[model samples]
Target: MKTYIHNFIAYKELLKELVQRDIRIKYRRSFLGMLWSVLNPLGMMIIMTLVFSHVFRAGIDNFPVYLMCGQVIFNFFNEATTMAMQSILGNAPLIRKVYLPKYLFPMSKVCSCFVNLLTSCIALALVVVVTRTPLTWKLVLFVFPILYVFLFSLGIGILLSAVVVTFRDLQHLYGVIITGLTYLTPIFYPIEILPGWVKTLVEMNPLTSFVEMFRDAVLYGVVPGMELHIRCIAACVVALVLGIWSFIKQQDTFILKV
Candidate 1:
């Protein structure tokens, strides 16, 4: 792990080039360009505010703000993982043609997705202001969970990138699986409404804790307590260890196939 960090720091220029290439490819030939990043989440915020807030009539305090907090983070995870699935395969030409660290492919995609996350976060802040949402320092606690989510996504992204390089078919399965998981997650709806058995079962998924943590901090101004923090840390550790170990073991042979 220390060696990987040292090598990444040593090859900062290569990382920069990869990140830049990813950013360019994302918005290439698009009129909206980077604004598209903020627009998707922001637009979904409005739609959720309208559909769930106005139409379905779920009783919650500041439902729009609640929805946006979950929306932004959930979308970030969904987009980052799916996009990074093909990260290595998409860069097969460069990886085969050059000597840059292969891990940079996944890292670069994560950076690009965070670029979008930052934009959506800013837009969400503006919405809070416009909606007269109360501000509190406790909301800052969200940074911890968001950071954990990033680490979680990074590990998962790297692992999936390796798999996708070998099996392109997994890319399609990823989308279907994530869509199903999204429903199981409490993004658009409250978790309390979930049945007892379902609640117990779904809570086993780390994303449940993550989405709940985000809603707690951003919407309710209450940070998740120690138990949730421990769970998040455990998730990140498991993902990192497994993902990095797999990549390191198999990455050398990646060039032969990818």
Candidate 2:
């Protein structure tokens, strides 16, 4: 791990350049450019508010903020992992040309999306202020869940980057899976609305904890309890371990596949 960290630090400049290139390409030829990051989620929040707020509003006070919280975090993971899945094939030339850490491609993609996620947080902050959601000390610890989501996303990203190099269909299949996950995730609705049996299934999802953690800190204005902290940490550790293992094992042949 120390050697890996040292190698990453040695190539930090290359990683930065890759991340910047990603951000530029994402916004290239667009007039609004990066502003779309903030607006896209805000626009979705407005649509969701108008459509579903009437149904779930009673249970979730500040429904827009609640909705935005789930949307931003889930979208971050989705975008990051999606990009990471394509990172290897997308940069086949770079991989072929020189010696570079193969994992850096996926890591750079995840980091770039993280930057976009941070920009989208402007919309969340606006919603919070506009709705007058209570500001509390718990909000200061909001970084905990964000860190968990990043680690989880990074783990999944590494795993997918390795897998997708060989199984190109995974890219398409993942799109469908992400669509299903969005609805199944209880993003716009509170889990309490579900019956006990169904609620258990939803709660079992690792992403659910991240979304719920966000609600707890930002909307509910309470510190996340030990259960949430433990769950997030466990999820992060498990995913990261699996991701690193998978990536290391498969990356040996990624050049041939890509």
Candidate 3:
């Protein structure tokens, strides 16, 4: 592990450049450039607020902020994993000619999406201010959920990048999966509206915990129970370990596959 850490550290500059390159390419032809990171989610929130706010009818005040909270977490995870899945095959030319750490390619993709997630948070904050939402000390605890989601997404990205190199079909499959998950998560609706079995299923979903945590901090302003925290931590750690292990095992043959 120390050897891997040292190697990654040695290639930190390469990783930074890869991340920067992705950010540039993402907005290369756009007029707003990075500003779209903020605008895109905000635009989605407006549409969601207009559509789902009436359909779901949650008692939660400031439904836009409530909805944006879920959007911020879900969108980050989706975007990060989607890009990471293509990272290896996308950079095949570089891998063929270079000696850089292979994992850095996917890691850089995750880092770049994280940068976008931060911008989306700015949009969320503006909504909070415009809605005149009350602030509480527990709002500071929002970082915990955000950190867990980051780790969880990073792990998933690593795993996907490793697998997608060989199973190119996963890219299409994951799009469907993410769309299903968005509805499974209580993004626009209250968990109480779910049937008991569905509620249990949602509770078991890792993203559910992160969404609930974000709602707890940003919307409810209460600290989540320790059990919830443990669950999120366990999910992140397990996914990360499995992802890293899978990548290390498969990376040896990636050159041939890509």
Comparing 1 with 3 on lDDT, the higher-scoring candidate is 3
- Model 3: per-residue lDDT, tens digit, 1-258? 998999988999988999999999999999999999999999999999999888776566679998999999999999999999899999999899978789999999999999999899899999999989888999999999999999999999999999998899998899999998988887888888889999998888899899999989987889999999999999999999999999999998999999
**By TM-score, highest first, what's the ranking?**
3, 2, 1
Put down candidate 2 lDDT per residue, 1-258, tens digits, no spaces: 898899999999999999999999999999999999999999999999999999988898889999999998899999999999999999998788888989999999999999998899898999999889889888877788888999999999999999998889998899899998887798999898998988998898899999999889888888889999999999999999999999989977877877
Predictions: Cα RMSD each: 1.6, 1.0, 1.0
Residue pairs with clashing backbones, model 2: none
Regions of model 1 farther than 4 Å from truth: 54-56
How well does candidate 1 match the true structure in TM-score terms? 0.94
Q: Which lDDT values do the candidates have, in the order given? A: 0.82, 0.92, 0.92
lDDT of 1: 0.82
lDDT of 2: 0.92
